[model samples]
Target: MEFVMPVFAGIVVIFGLVKRVPVFDIFLKGAKEGMLLLYNIAPTIMGLVFAVDLLRSSGAINVICNFVEPAADFLGFPKEIVPMVLLRPVSGSGSTALLTSLYQDCGPDSFAGQVASVLAGSSETTFYAVAMYFGSIKVKKIRHTLVAALIADFTAAVMSIITVRFFT
Candidate 1:
């Protein structure tokens, strides 16, 4: 009975004679348009992805990570947080991959692994999201957006680790 409402509505739409064309045609056309949109946006997405790749491969990430290590340590962060910090800015997937490695190294049920998982889940990929969305819409003014998003990500990362550590 719960699902019957949708089936009944679909039947009426397909069998009704006023429109004459099958309703499936409408869905097909919408799907085709969505595919076209993806194609148009692929270039911008690729550019963001490649820029992240270069950051990961260039050794610059390690240099930046070192500069922040002292402060991160003062905050009680594990040494591994450096790469997580760097990767979070450039690529979401790459960061997740590093997070996975951390989980494997520390064991999934260990404190560090659990904290990393929480941080990974809670934080946003601030730069990548802004770049992809702005480039897709051709918006040029991104002055404060990235800064705000990064602040939110930082808050989430810190709180995630704290909450996970305290609760479990």
Candidate 2:
């Protein structure tokens, strides 16, 4: 695996040389463009991160969790995963941390662990993705993208619970 990258890179360099392409100049141009794109998207990344943090530190998640506890319980989901359900779409790292905490608190073989695992695999950071993608393209008219992404995220959670129940 370690040798594969170097070998592939060497082959690419050889191929570029044979094609008379200015490999070094092309590489530098690509690097500069990548840096520029990163700069362009930095604000979007910061904004999303700040929003997710605010949702966490402001106790909004807790309030929302309390509100949803009854529905979650009736749906056969646990009381502990309310925060994850809310956060996964907004922030992947936050949800991953929550899932890790669930694993530690309930052990990996436990019901919560299995459900958390499924949720982690099934869902995505919808807001983060949308922010980055749309922000990169400067798309002001999001239309129904947010609604669709959130719906998919909700479906993932429901499916995770149902699937876990069936197998576990």
Candidate 3:
């Protein structure tokens, strides 16, 4: 395993050299482009981080959780997962932290833990992804992206509950 990366790199360099490609120069060029790309998306990333922080610190999460509690119950999702469900699309780390806490508090075999695990695996940080990719490319009109992504997230959450219930 330790040698895998080096071997892969060596193979790539050798292949590039054999193909008469300037590997080092091309690597430098790609690196420069990557750095500039990161610079372009840095603000989007920071904004997401800031938003997640605000969501937690503003007590808005608590309010939102309480507001969504009845729906969560009716949907057969654990009330403990309210935060995870809300935050999953906004921030992966935030949702993952909630999932981890759920696992610790509820035990991995508990319904809350099972639901959290399934939710974590089944969905993505939609807003962050959209902001990064669309912002980086400077896409102005996101016609169906947001709607489609939200629908997918909804499906994942519903399926997470049903699938976990069935399996357990």
Candidate 4:
């Protein structure tokens, strides 16, 4: 079914291209607009990255992970997933950085590393989504959404770790 779907999509795309539907020009225009949007948002992304790095270098992240380690273990989670939990709220890039470091420190096949990978994969970029959404619409009701999204991501993380550990 999936193979047939792709073949159908390819046929449609080829048909569109052959019919002189301005696909290339439309694509280039879309790409240009995307690049412009990216350029405008680059500073915000850089600032987010800097803040995350500052958190890491100033020992805040470590302190957080240290305090959460016992509770994490109590919940049957690996201790190394603590940073992933903390960074998930503030910055996705930060969580990814921590995830990478955990992978390197623990090695990918270890239980801790696999669990970290699952946690990282399961989480979302909460702050980035809120910022982009509010920024685009110029609306500012970001009160409960953060809490809700974090809860969802936490659920995803727990399920992902359990599933990956057991089913894989």
Candidate 5:
């Protein structure tokens, strides 16, 4: 594994030399472009982090989970997994923290833990991804992309619960 990168780099250098390509200069250019991309996307990432922190700190997630618990139960979703479902589309880290908490509270062998694990694997950080990608490209109007992504997230949550219940 350690030698793989060096070997790949050697192959690339040899290929560049044979092709008379300025590999170093090209690498520098790519690095500069990556930096510029990071610069452009940094604000979006920061805002997302701040928003997620604020929600967690303010107990907004708890409130939402409480309000949604009835519907979740009606739909056969575990009460303990509500927070993970709510956060999964918004922040990957937040959802992961919720999943870890669920694991601790309910045990990995518990139904809620199994559901959280499946949900985490099944969903995407929809808002974060859309914000970063569209923000980097300077696309202000997201059209129906946000709606579609959120719908997919909801579907993943529902299916995660259903699949886990079926298996268990």
Candidate 6:
């Protein structure tokens, strides 16, 4: 398996030589373009990382979870998974930490842990994806993308709970 990539690369180089293609020049051009794209998107990625750290360190996620707990309970969602649900859309690492905590506090066989596991698998890091993709292309106006992504995340959370409950 480790040799597959080297073999494939050798074949590509051989084929390019046969076709008289400038493989080295093309490789250099692609590498330069990738670096340029990274340069263009670096600021947005940094801002997102900073904001996620601020929210986590400032206890904003806990505050939001507290505020949402009642509504979540009323809607039949597991209140214990509130932090994971809230953080899942914005930061994958944050939600993963929250999920690990849930597993430790509630046990993996518990309802909350099961729901968190399902939610983690089913949902996307919507804000991170949108920021990275749009930032790479320099699209300043996202229109309804944020709203649509949030709605999808919410649906995934709800369905995760429902699916877990249905099976268990």
- The number of the candidate with the highest lDDT is 6
Model 5 per-residue lDDT at 113: 90
- Candidate 1 stretches with Cα past 4 Å from truth are 1-22
What is the per-residue lDDT of model 1 for residues 38-137, given as tens digits with 9 covering 90 to 100? 8767888888888877877898788888999998889888777668866886788888898889888888788778778887778778777787778777
Clashing pairs in 3: none
Query: Candidate 1, residue 134: CA error in Å?
Result: 1.6
Residue-level error in angstroms, candidate 3, position 113: 0.8
Q: What is the alpha-carbon lDDT for the whole of candidate 6?
A: 0.91
Q: In model 3, what lDDT does residue 16 have?
A: 98
Worst 10 residues of 1 by lDDT: 14-23
Candidate 6: lDDT of 164? Answer: 94
Model 3: residues with Cα > 4 Å off, grouped in runs: 1-11
- Cα lDDT, all candidates: 0.81, 0.90, 0.91, 0.79, 0.90, 0.91
List, residue by residue over 93-112, the lDDT tens digit for candidate 4.
67777788888999987888
User: How far is 71's C-alpha from truth in model 1 (Å)?
Assistant: 0.8
lDDT of 3: 0.91
lDDT of 3 by residue, 1-168 (tens): 999999999999999999998899999999999999999999989988998899899999999999999988887778888888899999888888888888889998898888888889889999999999999988979999999999999999999888988899
TM-score of 4: 0.75
Candidate 6: lDDT of 120? 92
Candidate 2 wrongly placed segments (more than 4 Å) = 1-20
- Give the clash count for each candidate: 0, 0, 0, 0, 0, 0
What are the runs in model 6 whose C-alpha is more than 4 Å off? Answer: 1-25
